[model samples]
Target: MAHQSKRTTLGEIGEHAAIRVIREECPSRNNGDDAAVLNQPAPNTRPVVATDMLVEDRHFRFDWSTPEQVGIKAISQNFADIEAMGARPTAALLALSAPKDTDVEVLRGIARGIQQALEPFSAQLIGGDITGGEKMVLAVTALGQLGGNRKELRLDAARPGQKVVANGRIGWSAAGLALLRKFEEIPEDLRPLVEHHCAPRIETNRGVIARATGATAMTDNSDGLIQDLRLIAERSGVGIDLKSHAIFPDELLCRAGKLTGIDPWEFVLSGGEDHTFLATTSKETPTGFRDIGRVNKNTGLVTVDGLPPRHEAGWVSF
Candidate 1:
């Protein structure tokens, strides 16, 4: 089942059976072997592949996010990368490394989360591996397909005079994280933001829309918006000027900012992990996307309304 599992802790499960339990308990389709066999892409299609890793304490915390939520976020983030390149995910492999003292129930929860994340998309969980380590770590490799001669939304394809468009929530995860760090009893109205921080729901079809709508470049806003756009700016050798009024915080983010004594613009401008779709289009903005900025001639610069933003440059891994 992708939702429930037997509740046995890691200490009770013992060391030798950890991998075996993971293989047996984790959900899959045509899996549970030394390796996985995947179907080739359909005719007139190109394959897309992406990987993302989640480290305990570095990327997530059990006290803040449930085991199931961590599992969901791990897979969802990887899927966001696949879609960012304008591809449809077809299969996934999850490799996990956790400590010997870890709970088997946590492993089951992660597996269930992975399966649940795949439910909305066409991808299948082909296989994975489990092993002992210093802490919990999850590495996911997702394989995708771009079909029908639609061009890939490469980051370097951006051009001057293109309109930058965005779809989905901006700064929600950051706002949620702020709440989790500061408040013990989160307000009911703001709890959803916190939940989003734990397990985000991405619109998997947005990348396809960008490809079909003549988008030249695209990326997911995993880092802060400006930081992520800078990738396109660097590769395409164009500047991207974001409109503050266009991407500025909504009422909830404003409320969170007021309560936290931080600028709401910081959340909108530099907050990371929202996985919102960002694209540069020469044609009219897609139906689901809103025009947020314009591509300009300034080389490799991302500005907010013609000036550098005041927030930090998104999430830094080092």
Candidate 2:
């Protein structure tokens, strides 16, 4: 859908061609970010739209991440929102802001990240805008097609006896951030976690599987696990008791925690940027999902190993 001189900077080419470089790198269905009609949803399916914005330093650091990684992270988060609705992302619009002196190669890399990230789910960029700003910012709006009724995936739909199931990586991003904060040169093995923090992965087709297997309620773990689960419990008038055995920190996270002197459970329980999917299913988990616990009648209570959390469970933007 959407460069020229070797090592040219944005100041050299100006913003117009900088836009062209991004367009040239990303795959597109329309001429550009315009009134291009998207593919119609499958018969009887409704459209799902989600947006996400990322800011420098707060969301990502240029020193810690490449422009490509930022692009990938930006689109992936928006796509996760669509996935939470049990929908397939089909199109997207990107809005980017940067200083005029920014390097053209950086824009190319960001576009490349967006291009590669959309490959797994077969989505395309339709339109976007670029502007001069004080900080590097990326805003993405994604459109998806839901093959089922919207009410089926509401947060308040969890019922007692439903199994609490989850899929996707957890804690990896937070662990990565910790390592980045503490170390100048990251260990080779820990680099995957850092990579994940930069461009969180979305397991392909798992959302579709959850929908097909009759998910009752679903959410993506953008906030910490306990904090997000509390939202479901509060809204649905139920409680969620998680089994520590089911979601204990894995070997990589344990290693990271040991290195940083931070308990691995802290990462596992409170880490949020991983975009892991949490859902309420029946007794059997859908493919690619693991049963973590069960829903109960006690409303507004989320417990770990049968006890309330020892500390605040998630990130607060305020």
Candidate 3:
């Protein structure tokens, strides 16, 4: 008789067990309730909510990303959107759609990832649903709290004289994707870039800081610097004049681009998924952020040193 493997599947573990796995990692206040009971914000504060969905082949691939990476990516992206509003992420709701044949360990790994990603912000995974599907689909809804008397940052608030600033890594994810596509075996040096593409780490607290320091407008760089800035410019009736030399490219990204024969500037200006924080500020640039450009009254334009970008601006879902 041949020996049999004992791999546990979603069907074997059932929904309760699956919930146990997630709650074990990040226990909810309303553990067994039909809906999570959350604390109401203080006077004058408002809730900031954002959601992101990741489909199997479209947002990620199992061969390149682990279940943990997928979970982290989903949480980080949604949280970044909340942060863009200059708020502190408080909690999240997760929804998983996967094939019944999916391994229970994979689900547990995803839970662990979500828990770890929320650790820095003191956020919790409050509630969610799990269902069967043809491919793995993860949807994360992140909720945030905007505190203090400062106004919430909006894209339309950017002004003509406000300085453009950025905090956190940019272009690394796009560079990573470029390397991943070109080479069968990624070099050891390039592993960091690949990891960045799989799981980006944004500056979570800068959102609140930007608010306190009087940010005129803000946005996350998930859609590339130029593209996201264009959104601010278009919404605010202003143009952004970026200094060509002001946008710094990391050495690793430059090397990656050189090796792949791709322009590093393209990744800097057009690549998405970095999730860095970008803002227009009236006061001095906040600590942890570097000056990149200035907002102009020209409106509806984003230029690099007075010239339009040669490459495309950013990612388009359609």
Candidate 4:
């Protein structure tokens, strides 16, 4: 409702006012400083950092996604990158750029969304900058700490005999996007898919669990499953074989695909932005992960049920 009120532009309130809004909405441990002062990290641990950028029309559209949703999605993707490396997120720095005429409430909504997204991990917003730009853009940098004796998961550590497993859902976001593009009004049954596209709630704890459980390699499925697997295969000098039957195809995706005249399998193989954790393990699969395949001697290939996917490319930025 505040967003609906008479537009209070960022230019009118000034930069300090905007920063005050962020500070109030997303309070951090450190305040009144040029840079956040973090406590010394745990001994015998390493820091993991990841950064991602989201641009209007390219990553999301104002008509399809709210300011809050944009904020959440941006944070989710960056935090997911940290988790995939077998670490726990500790803090974030958000840099936002938008037209001077943009509504201050919209920016506040974005700050609130960022705070909400980090609540599950007890992470905080450390510091960032805002500037004027032609279109809305958000650059998020997530910082994480890897603790304990467990080795950090790497994409190149996968080896032959290691089992390929996955945590979290796939294809749901792709299905949601499809529905949004094809239908004028989304059906009630497919609302969950649309929600996924707007804001994915990835399981952050799974990364730590996988590392503790002896995961050999891990990566987040921001790109399609096949595309990410190929990265592992190439980096590890191994091949991966995904068992089609092992993948838990969601019923919602199937229904959406049928309605849209698209194959759900395509979405499963090539769709990205699910932020699901995909990993390899020589030991028992982690509690939350489902075994999907295995690593094999290098053939420089990734296959599903011994056959190459119809499409190999996932989300590509050019």
lDDT of 2 at 18: 79
Clashing residue pairs in candidate 1 (N, C-alpha, C atoms within 3 angstroms): 10-103, 10-104
Q: After superposition, how far is residue 223 of candidate 2 from its true place, in Å?
A: 1.2
Candidate 4 lDDT, 172-210, residue by residue in tens: 888888898898799998999988888888886788889
Better of 2 and 4 by lDDT: 4
Which runs in model 1 stand beyond 4 Å of their true positions?
Answer: 1-7, 11-26
Off by over 4 Å in 2: 1-7, 149-151
User: Residue-wise lDDT of candidate 3 within 1-318, one digit each (tens)?
Assistant: 399777899988888888888889878785557888888677888889999999998888888888888888989999999989999998999999989888988898888889889888998999999888999999999999999777899999999989999998878999999998898899998899999999887766889989888896998998888888899999999999998777767799899999899999888999999898999998978889999898887889999888998665688786
Off by over 4 Å in 3: 1-5
State the TM-score for model 2.
Answer: 0.94
Task: TM-score each candidate.
Answer: 0.93, 0.94, 0.96, 0.96
**What is the C-alpha local distance difference test score of candidate 4?**
0.88
Candidate 2: Cα lDDT at 228:
86
Error of 4 at 280 (Å): 0.2
Candidate models: Cα lDDT each: 0.86, 0.86, 0.88, 0.88
Ranking by TM-score: 4, 3, 2, 1
Worst 10 residues of 4 by lDDT: 1-10
